[model samples]
Target: MRVLCATALALAAVVVPALTAQAEQPVNLGSTQIVDTVGALGGQEAEVESALNRLYNATGAQLFVVYVATFDGVAADESWATATAEQNGLGTDDVLLAVATEERIYDIFYPSDFQLDTEATREVENEFLPLLSDENWAGAALAAADGYREAIEGPGFPWGFVLGVLVVGAVVIGIVLVIGRRRASARHTAELADLTKLEQRASRALVHLDDSLTTSEQELGFAVAQFGTEASAPFVEALEAARTKVGEAFRIKQTLDDGVPETDEQARAGLLRILELCDQADDELDRQADAFDELRALEQAAPQTLVQVRADAERAAARLSAAIEALRLLEQRYSSAAVATVEDNTEQAEMLLTFVGRTASQAEGAIAAGKSGSAAIQLRTVQASVAQAGQLLDAIDSLGDRLAEATQSLDAVVADTRHDLAAAKAFQAEATSAELSAGIAAAEASLAVAESPSTLANPVARLERLTAANQELEGTFGRTRDAHTRIQNARVALDGTLATARGQIVAAGDFITTRRGGVGETARTRLAEANRRLDQAVSLAGDDPVAALAEAQQANSLAGAAISAAQSDLTSYQPVGPSRGMFTGPGVSEAVVGGIIGALIGGRGGGFGGGFGGGRSRSGCFGALGGFGGSSRSSGGSLGRSIGRSVGRSAGRSSRGRF
Candidate 1:
């Protein structure tokens, strides 16, 4: 019975994973001609879709255009496009063009029985590649459509085949060939310029990685000395892996630098490889550095941290009575729903403060007994508890202020919303659509609710409802608005969106900062990207409020994602058992090592440096926001840096090449 059960379990495990994989396969757009998931075509999606549909009707050969972020972890662009085509039951009569905007790569897929000849296919790709390289996404889609149509229709009868016409045509052809040669020369020059820039970038990345590795090595030595070899094994392993990557990067650079001729493609590939290696090395080093920093802080800064935690706890405890009083007052003035978020905040604060106190005492005992690892863990717990307690107390204290602000802003917002609704109604009166009518109705309902006396008790909720409704109305009629008016509206919306994005980013940063022990690269990367986007939003707010609004929204999304990723990481974190032969344990050793290395490296902050935003440059801390460039960084693939491929089953014939 045991053998039978074991066999069944094994089979189930294999089958379950297979089923899951199958279920997760990428979905194909059966009839949709344009899939702009990344919004790369902006508002021109309809225009592009129309062109593609026209081409399909004209030639009976559908051309599916897809734009995505980064192929969603797919390794090959062609494979992904081919898989989609196969899934859609497409064959020689159809083509799929998949573009990953973030990765800056694209592929064209068709079946073996594809209608177009090889030259025609090449011509179609040529038509769009230049536009794509220029980031003219809409233009590229249109160009592709036109190119396919032209290929299918072919040139009309040679009317210039008469004697005199043929002579004129010959001269024209000669002139065209000369112009083409000149253009080709210009293109070659441009390509070389781009390659040179990539080469320089690769060199800079290599230097940065090399410097990081050196600092990490020194830190690793200190860690080993303090914690012993066994405890510092992870860092050692990470350092070695980083070194290996650096070595490969250097080798590639050497080959490129050697006094030997190489093709432009070859050199570009080498440079991209160097950058990829550096990126990978940096990621590995950053992860280990974060862990090391946490370990070091607990061991070396335990006393100070413990004191801080205790101080915070005392302050939170002191505020508990005031918080309770505030909540009581709010409850009298507001409904249960309005005060519910903070009703139990005071009690929770009190309990957390008590836990902090107990943890602090245990941590002190552990510190005194030279059990630094245990002390560090206990100190971290105390810190977290104190922080939570402070948050709870603050929520109680801030609720009334928040409500007051919402109430104060509600009247003005309501006025603006009414004005917007008037404009929407005027537009709807001109030519009413179901979408516009629905939006107008929703706005009216939301406005009515916002003005209700009962809803006044929850001013924040009312404000949110009104804001959302107004936004929907604006979206519905935005295209009809004059450019100036649209910009004015966007300016009004941008401020609130920016504020919300900033708050979310700060909250996520705080969470990750406090509980970084379990946080991984994904959270850090998202946080960095959020900061970068926020910065961009701020910069663009004056001139391009609409773009700024979009950027702010993206920043808010990224921040939320960061928080989610961090929470997941923390949830999955598993503590390792204590290692032998250390002063306090592995934790203490890591702290010591981190401190020494940080100092040796002149306390240069870790994690992507200030390239993200104007964040602090703290050693081993999530400081300098801009260094990693997050999703902005070029992820090297077959087409070189910043290029990506899609992952999908190999089911159709396709040609993959770089733009």
Candidate 2:
């Protein structure tokens, strides 16, 4: 009686506590439709995914955990273990999930590097994050899961049937097929595994597309924010481009939404490709945005380049103003600079009229005081001012006659100035040449005294020594020895020449800057322009960036034209025809081949001396002498001069280019 009583008490003890706990805690009873992943361990076959779903139904066990695997028949199978979570209405490895149990919460993830247990029979229970506080299941969390599963079904999937089952689980998993979302009278969806596989593939693709769209939105917003105002035009274009792509993506997404519409693997692949295009468009839109920003920056820099040009123009204007001031001083001597500037320079010839009507006798006796210069000076000065005012002006050069007369009075002064300039230039040139020669002499002297090829300052001798070294090296060292020696010699020679040429060139530049004065300025301007053009040509000619020759040609044309115009000096000289290369005598055509063949006494290639005789010979000989055929006179070398002379002669009769 005592033993039986003790056993009874212990049993009662266990039973009472179990009842108490069961009363306080909630049970997460899941739909029997889903299987238990841990059923082999005596766990419940139906594991509650959401604590709220169980509590709402009021038939669940506490400590709800979603089954990584659901038992198809109250037990896990090898085939079911390997099956994707989506195939069983569970979450994919990549999906994020939230679930609540009686006492805890979980989050589930599938990183790329994740490894699944192949050997352990226990199904992987992915943890989902909780969205609840109560032990009893919240209805909201279950509602969320229902919508989430619908999202995987896509608009085109049999979502209505799937939702019906998730709603009450007694909308039997089998019944889900019997009354499809679109199967109005057809009774049920096809539940074949093959069809399910196709559905899963489409679901995965849609998921990827959704994710990419979210990324696109974020990236595009970021890019637009970065652009600022200067990017308005390009930003608009890029936005339009992206919008078009997004529309295309929507079409593809719609196709995907027609869930599992494909009948075969090929169709699946095609659908995947469509998704890929969407991804690609997304990437390209972002890339194009970057390019657009760069282009905008380039446009902004253009204004800066223009500003540089304006600054250069202002400098040129300043120089021109200075030259005009000097001209004002020169004109001040004759008449009121203001009046003479307004009068016809030759109207000062009216002053000459005063002289002419008076008499040579009166003119000869006129002025002795303050007349240090010739009378012609005063006459020319007056004439120049008058002519400039356009009263009696003919041509700018017309003033040359009066100018000569005036300058003749200053012959001694000009002579003295010219003498000084010539003397300075001579000394400058001599000193430059002397310094250069002295360096060369020293090098040569050193070269002459060297005995050994290796020790010599002469590069060729050094090279020779290197060659000997290479010859002696013979085995593996030969080529290396020769290369080293040659490099050393070449390096030495290059250094010497560069050092000696450096100072002479520098000194010559000094003289150019000092003596040439404004000419240096003009030359510097022209050279700089030329260099810029050359650089532009190189930039244009770039293989990927631009083309080389075309850039070079454009650069050359710009620089050449500028230099040619600068040479004509429109600010000083009257307009002249564009300068051509050295002018020379006119051309006579000659066929070199014809003349040579004629000398060989062979064929017409030698002209008249060749085997061909009579008319052919005469024609050949004449053609050879003309150096051309078809009466197309050769004119390249002497063309410029010939044209100049002809034009000048014609100008004597009519308006044309003279010099």
Candidate 3:
């Protein structure tokens, strides 16, 4: 009974919607020994009818059979069979075998006190279900009739009918094998095409990175000549590291192009390796290029750059007051945690602006005193401070917009969560598992909180809560859903997840760009990785949405870590003194130099490595002693009450499932 309940729950999750949609009016069997709605028994209908008549004569138990395209909106096969049986006034000695051919489901139902209990009925189903699978419909019907006869009158098995079924089954098996082969061939062709595209992409990336490296090498030479070896050493090291990666990529390419044959998996791995190496090389080169560009700008136009920094500082100062006012307004409407990310943004911006002002004054004095080296250092400090201040101000200004988007997303996810709860309830109605019931109750409680008016004050947190609750509910029935349903659910969730990921990535990227002076290698590395993953998610969204959703969620998490790491780095950062050297500044490591340089030189140039590639009836002959029967029962009884009772109780002694 427990097993039957669980199986019903599992099948109910998947088949309910389909059953409900295709449901028609109740079909009344009404003394008909055989009702083949779709002609499932073919030309042997009379033979199957004859067998049923023989079973009735040998044992007074009547067997009523009904075949339809589907259960006509009934939630389960057992329920449909029971309704049809009772609707035709089938008595204590009667049995009903109902088949929904299109759905590949059938059930055998008899009175609870009938001679054939659950185990006996299971035996009856085992006799005919295999023939049903072979589409020997007439054979299946005959087998069922014989099974009932054997149960009542002792052994008289039909070996002749079994032999005929075997012949038909062999033909079906051969056809299935041929179809399987064709599908296998199609899959192989698709794999080959994918491999070819990957290889081509890797080759293109290798060529582009190689060209960019060459150009970067020339730029590194110019920097050394202009700034001397000590100042240019970091760029030199960065270029060497990039060259090492590019060289490795070339080796993989050469191996791939060699005469040595490789398996498709091996070739794919090699191609991916090539792409990975190329991306690493480009990142290394760009980091150095950015640092080099900053050095060049400072050295060539210190006075002009100092003027620009001052102007930027003045503009940021003007925005600081407005940002503070906006934060205060937001604070009144939301909780501290809701606006915590930007609560101190205005204060940070004001402090940075003051630091910039002092630094700029000192830089001007140094320039007046004809101390070029000291002035360059002071100007660089002022430049970085002004940029950080602008970022702080921007953060405060953007918080309201982010909150608004979160509120909208919260609404959408709440609706999705409710839909999940409805499905879980449907499954619970069929099986009533304690675990499933607890999950549904928990999710419903979460939804109650999430839908409260106060939840709007912290919409982001509410969204997370609702999403988590929905996920827990999904886990309860995740294995029960068909692949198509699972994929469709993923696609629906993906849009919001991707939007969240993109928003976080953009915010983190802007922080890194403006405050790179304080951000360290780890944060920058994570940010880059997040961007790569987000690109991959977008590319895979149409074809593999489950994978895409995973990737997007990962990107969101990584971006969050990047934001935390960058914020921590900024808080602990100390402005380097002029004594550290003209080129050295806070947060500027060798890898950072390489990243900046790579960006300056490769700036969206075309080529392969140009950017991150987003990657039955049995007929029995009538027995000689078989006699025909007239109508056995009136056809006036309603199926509604019988169906209601079946739905109300746990399934009883029945053998039921898809063929």
Tell me the whole-model lDDT of each prediction, alpha carbons only. 0.71, 0.35, 0.70
RMSD to truth, every model: 37.8, 49.4, 37.5
lDDT of 3 by residue, 103-122 (tens): 89887777766767677778
> Where does candidate 3 stray beyond 4 Å?
1-237, 246-287, 290-302, 325-334, 362-384, 397-659
Candidates sorted on lDDT, descending? 1, 3, 2
Reference-based TM-score of each model: 0.35, 0.15, 0.34
Name the lDDT of candidate 3: 0.70
> How does model 1 score by TM-score?
0.35
| Model 3: worst 10 consecutive residues (lDDT sum) | 608-617
Q: Poorest 10 consecutive residues of model 2 by lDDT? A: 650-659
Over the stretch 327-359, how does candidate 1's per-residue lDDT look in tens digits?
A: 888888777888888888888888888888888
Count of backbone clashes, every candidate in sequence: 11, 48, 39
The reply for model 1, stretches above 4 Å from the true place, is 1-264, 279-305, 328-348, 372-377, 412-444, 455-457, 467-659
Cα error of candidate 1 at position 447, Å: 3.8
Clash count, predicted structure 1: 11
Return the top candidate by lDDT: 1
Quote the positional error of residue 172 for candidate 3 in Å. 34
Number of colliding residue pairs in model 3: 39
